[model samples]
Target: MADKVRVAVLISGRGSNLLALAEHKRRDPDRPYEIVLVASNVPEARGVVLAKRLGLRTWSLSHKGMERRLFDQKLDTVLREHDVELIALAGYMRLLSPEFVERWEGRILNIHPSLLPLHKGLDTHRRALLAGDEYAGCSVHVVTADLDSGPVIAQTRVRILPRDDADSLAARVLEAEHELYPAALERYAHELRGAIGEGREGGSDD
Candidate 1:
C-alpha cells in the first residue's frame, strides 16, 4: 500500500522484540506499517537468521573494528535503500553516534528495559532490585543523542514482588516490553503518517 509506513528494525541479539513486532504486523493485516528490513552489526546475530526465516530482507554489517559513525553511515544507507520511513531498535546493544541520532531524530524509536530517567544505562533490573525499588518497567522512547534519555512515548510498569530477583523481574519486564513496544510503534506509525500528510498538504500551496 502506498500509505503504509515502511519500517526497519535494528537488532544485536535474539530479536525478541522484532518477533513481537513482526507477529503483530502479521496478525493485523491493516496495520499501518510494513517491516521492510532487519539489520544487525554482528554478522552472526540470531536476529538476522530469524528475520530471514520470516522472509524479511536482512543485512549484516560487522562493526567490530569500524568507527561508530562510519558503521552508522552504512546502516543509514541500507535503511534508505529499503525506503524505510521508521526505525525500531530492538535489543540493539550498540550506542549510536550523535550524527546518526540526528539524522533519524524523531523517526527512530527504542525500547529500554527500565522505566527510564531512572536506570539510564545497563543492568537495569539488577539496579532496581539492589535499590529496593517497588516497581520496574519498560519504556518506549524516541531515540536521541542521550542514552535512554529521550522523550518517552509509552511505558508498561510491573510491580516488584518481595520475592523477586533480577532475573525474575527482568523476565516480567521483558514481557511488558513485548506488549508495550508494538503498541508504541503503531502509535508512532500513525503519528508519522499524519505528519507526512500535513507536510504534503502544506507543500500543495506551490
Candidate 2:
C-alpha cells in the first residue's frame, strides 16, 4: 500500500474547518491524506489545543513584528522538518509571501468564505449582503500569491435570506465551508496521488 499523503493544517482562529477535515479522516480510514501537523501563527488559537487532543503534533510561532518573508521561512522549515507534503489553510488570517506560495504552489489549499472572484478579502459575508447578492457561498481553492485568486476545487452555496445580517450570513457560509473543504481536500488528495504516480513513471526512463 502506498503511504498516505502527509498534510499540515495552518490555522489562526477557531479551526472549525480543521476539525471538519480531521473528522472526515476519522470517519474514513482509507482517506488518502493524513494530517501530521496542526500549526498556527497565534499561540492562543483554539485549534492547537484541539489538535493536541486529537493526538496530532502542533506548532505555534507568533507572526507579530516579523517580516512576512522571514516568518514564512521559519514556517517552511517547520513544515519540511515534519515532511509535510501538503498544506491546508483554515481561517489562517495572514497572507503568505510570494516565495512561500511559489515553493508550495499546487500543494497548498485554502478555504475562503465567499464564492471567490466576488469577495476576495475579509468581511465577505457583509460585502455579499451589501452588494445585494442573491446567494453567498464558500470556495476551496489552491493557494496562490494573488490572494483568493486560485483554481477552485469545490464550492457550496447557501441562499441569502433578505433578513440576513453579517453574522447570520457568515454563519451560513461557515457551515458551507465546513462541508466543502473536507470534500475538496479529499478530491485534491486523489489528484495529487495521480500526479505523483505520473512523475515517478516519467522518471523511470531517466
Candidate 3:
C-alpha cells in the first residue's frame, strides 16, 4: 500500500457497479485506493448488506426524513471520517447539490450508462434504442452539479446492433462501464499521485 489512495463509494441501490469497482480494487491490492466506504441513501440498499458482509464500513443516512442540506452534511461528515481522497458514485440516484459538489469538487467521479451530452438523465438504454442510435456507450466523468456536465475523463462505445433492445443495450453498456471506470480511476490516481511529487505530467485537471 505504499502508493495507495483512499476512495469512498456512494450507491443508492444494488451496488453492482460498486461491486465491480471493489473487484477491480481487489485485483490490484498493491494499487492505490481501496473501497473504503459504501454508503446509501436508502436504508435497505442491498449493497450495504453486501459491504458489511465483506467487513467494509457501511452507512445509510436515509433521504426520507432529512432535508438535502442536512443529508449532504451528514454525508460530508462520513466521507471526512473515513479520510476519503476520492469519491466514486456508482448507482447513486439523486442529484448532488451545488454545496456538496463544491465541497468535494474535482475529487468526485461518476459513471454514466451512455455517451453523455446525449441522454443526460435516466432511461438511457430505452432512449438510445428508441432514438435509433448507431452506438451506445458509457462515460466516466468528474462530477458537477449540472448532472453529467463535468469534464470528460474517459469513455468507450459499442455498436447498437439492429436487434439490440433496451435490456440488451443496458447489459453491453454495463460491461463498458466495468471496463472503463476502473481504467479511468487508475489513470486518475496515478496522475494525481505523480503530481503530488512535483506536478510533472498528466493533462490539467478540468
lDDT (0 to 1) per candidate:
0.92, 0.91, 0.85
Alpha-carbon runs more than 4 Å astray in model 2: 204-206
- Tell me the deviation in Å of residue 66 in model 2: 1.1
The C-alpha RMSD in Å for every predicted model, in order, reads 1.3, 1.2, 4.3
Predictions ranked by TM-score, top down? 1, 2, 3
lDDT winner between candidates 1 and 3: 1
Candidate 3: stretches off by over 4 Å: 1-3, 196-206
The lDDT leader among the candidates is 1
**Clash pairs detected, candidate 3:** 4-32, 5-32, 5-33
Which tens-of-lDDT digit does each residue in 1-206 have in candidate 3?
13466788899988888878778878878666677888889879988888888778898878987789889999999999998878989989978878999999889999999898779889998998888899999999999889788998999998999889899889888888988998898888776666554543444787
Over 67-87, each residue of candidate 2 has an lDDT whose tens digit, in order, gives 999999999999999999999
What does candidate 1's lDDT look like per residue over 60-83, in tens digits? 998998999999999999999999
lDDT of candidate model 1 versus the reference: 0.92
Please give the distance, in angstroms, between residue 105's alpha carbon in candidate 2 and its true position after superposition: 1.2
Candidate 3: RMSD to truth: 4.3
TM-score-better candidate, 1 vs 3 = 1
TM-score of each: 0.97, 0.96, 0.91
